[model samples]
Target: MSGTISRRSLSSPLSALALLALAAGAVTACTGPQAASEPEASRSASPETGQPVGATRHMIDNGGHDLAFYVTQGTGPTNVLDSGGGEDSSYWKDLVPELHEATGATVITYDRAGLGQSDAVPGPWQVESAVSDLESGLEQLGVTDDVTLVFHSQAGQIATCLAQENPALLSGAVLVDANLPPFFTDERIERLVAFSQPQLDAAKEDPDDPQNRQLLSTAESFVATSTAFHRATWPDTVPATVIVSEKTPFDGSPEDVQRWKGAAESFVQAGPHRTLIAADDSSHDVAKDRPDLVLEETENMVAAQR
Candidate 1:
């Protein structure tokens, strides 16, 4: 639909593939909390919203690499906000305070490897490794239980794997227009790979770029990763809230729009605690468009846990 795909689009496996295919040459891309009390230098105020940015910044080691996380300390259940592909913790800057103030729960946000202030890791991006990065960060922060994860876009994949692998680490989840297993059927994967071929070829010209690196890495393992992801299940023990955008990631194609919405529906229907909320008049970036709703639902989830 649009002439170009934003880096945030990279979060959705299919959305990025389809949009990248359409744009071909016109793609623009581009946390942790911790043991620290240092103020963030680069982040202070949102130029647009003027909201104060994230709290104290800290860096933690994930294996040999460093990942950045920011924390706004509170007392209740911890709310961990994760961005989609090509995005960092700053994406959630505005909402971080709102969430902390409303729920009084510590709000933690981080940059994935190679994005934001986090160290770059060579090779393609792997879901398992992303899970490890999150896992390591949480454990190091002494956050072992009662974490309410709020993930958007591509982070959904990581959230899905984490839920299955470490249900005990999470109390509830808010999936903001994230990817789901039902959407990654064999046919969809085939179509996604086909559409993404042009972008994959384009990425080769600048593989060193962070955005390109992610694209290359994702393309390298998408087939197998998505296939496995499709087979993976979310733990029924974890309560989840699924927020589907009005114009899902595939807003350009009416056919894809239906499929994306249907997949989210299927994901919610399959579980008991899982609930689906429609984000009206929003694009793929639901948090940006409907911060109120995101905060409301997230606070509700935290309230439910208490």
Candidate 2:
């Protein structure tokens, strides 16, 4: 925990242990924060509907800071695509139009605080803040009900909190290779924090780096946040579809892999409308590896809602 973190602890330019920190609902910097002073506005008139296929970007004021949102025009049952740790709204760029075209549902994607075009707030990452951003952003967008939330990885924590706090706002959800409360057991959280410590320490070297800043933010509140998350539960009334990748985020460790998949299984089993689908030939990033599967499941969920 005091030295260089092993690659097996996580991966990539963010840090060797970013995934571990990410699963713990900490260290959200995958590609770090980029300077996005203004939201880019782009649109192309669609041939079929004459509506804009490209996203109409908006910089919504959430408290004092701005959270960037890309909204595609369509009908009701708004589909919101939220990215994982270290990612921004652009992560869903490829899937937005496809979803909108298929379901004729208003598609939305946004950058979390500290990522993409959004303004970053100082201090530790708070799930409550994340939930507030979504709630307020939707309210400002005039999105009231029948919302389908599709989220991945670290965004799962936000989804969990949202379901508990604002279950009335959502019609359904699609969780793609997301971290679950069952996976954040006490022993698992201890190991995750331990694995993430070295990376957290390394973050201090380049304190100004946005990625490091995010990693550092976790140092103060990761354990507390993750501990609280472990005891949190998704409402049984909210129907959910869980897509679990074959090679989980912890594919490097067989023990963790089983636990990860087990969590998804347990989650689905605990509820009435919950379903689990296996992404047979994918890794932790199932959306990228098997978007067809993700799309299929999401479309099914949306159809069920209608």
Best model per TM-score = 1
**Best of the candidates, lDDT:** 1
lDDT of 1 by residue, 1-306 (tens): 223333454454334752211000111101333444344564455463232465666678767788877777789689999977777788898898889999999999988898777899887567777888888888778888999999987888888878877898899999998888888877777877866777778778987877777778777777777777777788999999999999888666777788889999999999889999999999998999999999999999999999
> What is the TM-score (0 to 1) of candidate 2?
0.86
What's the lDDT of the predicted structure labeled candidate 1? Answer: 0.78
Give per-residue lDDT, candidate 1, residue 133: 86
CA lDDT of each prediction against the hidden true structure: 0.78, 0.75
Would you estimate the TM-scores of all the predictions? Answer: 0.86, 0.86
lDDT of 1 at 286: 91
- The parts of candidate 2 lying over 4 Å away from their true place are 1-9, 12-53
On the 0 to 100 scale, the lDDT of residue 230 in model 1 is 78
